[model samples]
Target: MAEAYLLEEVSNFTTKYYADNLPSVHNPPPRYNVAENESSLSLFQGQLGSASGATSKFLAYEEWRTIMLYVLTNLKETMSYIEEFIHQFWRRSRDPTSNEIDTLLKQGAGSGKPDFISWFKKKIDLTEVFGMEVDNEDARDEVDDAKDLQILERLHLDSDDDIPPPSDNLHDYVDMHDIDDETHEPAIIDDDDYF
Candidate 1:
């Protein structure tokens, strides 16, 4: 979760830096306020470390400053590269020619098919494009005790009878005759001493 938040902050910083210093925007100010941004980040890192009890050292202030400056210097082009990289990564991760999307959104309006994002939103909402219910509605309910018992029976989970008992002859292999049982005698305590 911390990593996700850190990545989100990085993304926001990059995009904001690019938008602030874009050449087309005419006479833009300097890309960074080091006192505000760098100190805020360092404080965040310290808080994160303390909260997580992290032993790993955070980047030194100078190192972090250098990195921020480098990113700010190339902000616009860097953001464009990042955007393209994300698209390429997702394309590689999923089948480019997938028709699962088409099948999922056949009932939608105005066009031949819904896009992936719309289809995904419908999936999230557990609904079809035209407001029909999902097929496996009851399947989402928690299993009842009877159903749980049935599953346990099917899995042979109710019985410990299958497990082998410890052998009584285990002492036959190990010599225990030398140990004096009297060594474990209970100590005689005087209750009157406590009183």
Candidate 2:
């Protein structure tokens, strides 16, 4: 049941993301779709579809690159989720508070079957996959800091300046003594007041 739910969630998420970001047509002309002509098989060929469809096959290099990037990014994120799910499942089912799960994962590393441990631990490199380098943590942080600095400069604000503390003395702003102490009785209004 859990596996089915996870599969459904992943499928829905992927479908929604593709629909929102990519072209509406699933199969573009062979000329516009590189996958159609490429004979190379990928590990995810089943999910991504094998290159055996007929369509126009003339896509611009930039457009093809963008599509590849989108697919690779989605694949990386999906794989991360799957890895986390497997880890969590193993941890909860085997040992919640012991290192047994880790031992088992390490043991599975050399099992010759799909190395779950290595796949879980290994980070995907987009550059190696598609010759396009992705920003690392440091580069991302630098870009973010540059953007923040630009925003601050545009607003004429100094990054080092501290925000003034909120005033703690309310009496300094409001004169409580000037307030009337009289308690007026409620007036009984006649119907004439409505007019």
Candidate 3:
């Protein structure tokens, strides 16, 4: 039940974020149109059509990158909160004063598993939820991908429009050091190489 709740909360968070920030096709801004490029996989893609009727893909990518960074920032906060809550719950469940294991043992809960550790192992399985395998180690790939997105480089738009300065307190919430601190450059890709 907790696993289901967690998944639902995460889904709602992601949905709400995009709904609030990215404008819909029915209600686009003055200069920008909700991007019509179905091939573009990036979130919050907006196209600013030139007077010549030429659309720049780079502009859409740039805008999407900024919007995605904001969403990632928000997701980081949400994940942190959820992680803290999980930690608290785990700590409380294992606290000696709680006597959870004692109560379980008193009720003769263990069948073949005699010890608390063995019994607890049977109670919770982190491997899968709702038929889908849940792997925490998958975060390694996400970290690598996030490092690829250099927020500093994409912070401002090239257009004449005024870009709001990123929050000074962003450092408090976002750890820029998640990727290697010494390297500031993005990974170079060969002409033939593709992700």
Candidate 4:
């Protein structure tokens, strides 16, 4: 489209005509809170942080002003094209005698059914894009319990069965005093309190 507009065959006025009009067909007004100014960006010049396409003639400064030429030119071209397109489209769609425009204004398509389905799916815990974990923890516990019962049954322990005592003297020997072989006394900490 741009190429055709720029070519010699297409009359400059006609190219301008289409360029002026297309937005009336497609463009809907500000959704997503698109502010005209999308906040400002910062620029700094350092040994490593040199501005692109800047030569030795460049200075340490310029800031937003440096890019303003390129930015404004591009913005102007883009906005002119958009407005021109809207005008051209309006010209095409409406009755020539009628002053009113035949614009295609649109509203939100109501995110209802898909949202409800998604919510229901999440509530039911069915499938996810990252699929749901299929493991049943309760089932695993039941299996473990059954295996334990089987092992106990195989061991055949009578109601009157007696078990042998453990050999490790649990209470027979207490933790003895930390002492020399010749002398036995608990190791004491040097503190303010007299023990």
Best by TM-score: 2
Clashes of 3: 0
Q: lDDT of all the models against the reference?
A: 0.38, 0.41, 0.39, 0.33
Query: How large an RMSD does model 4 have?
Result: 29.7
Minimum summed lDDT over a 10-residue window in model 3 is located at 113-122
Clashing pairs in 4: 19-85, 20-84, 20-85, 21-84, 21-85, 21-86, 21-88, 21-89, 22-85
**What is the TM-score of each predicted model, taking all chains together?**
0.13, 0.17, 0.16, 0.12
lDDT, residue 156, model 2: 35
Please report how far candidate 2 places residue 144 from its true position, in Å.
Answer: 32
After superposition, candidate 1 runs with Cα above 4 Å error: 1-58, 61-74, 91-195
lDDT of 1 by residue, 1-195 (tens): 999999877866666456443533343333542222344332233222223444766999658645553543344533443333234234345653334323222222233333223333323344432265442223124223334223323433212232222344333233344434787333455799799
Quote model 4's TM-score: 0.12
In model 4, state the lDDT of residue 60: 46
Q: Which lDDT tens digits does candidate 3 get at residues 60-158?
A: 864765554345334543344334323423334344333553343332233322222222222223222224432323322332333322432342223
Q: What TM-score does structure 3 among the candidates reach?
A: 0.16
- Cα-based lDDT at residue 130, candidate 1: 24
lDDT of 3 at 138: 36
**How far is each candidate from the true structure, as Cα RMSD in Å?**
25.0, 24.2, 25.6, 29.7
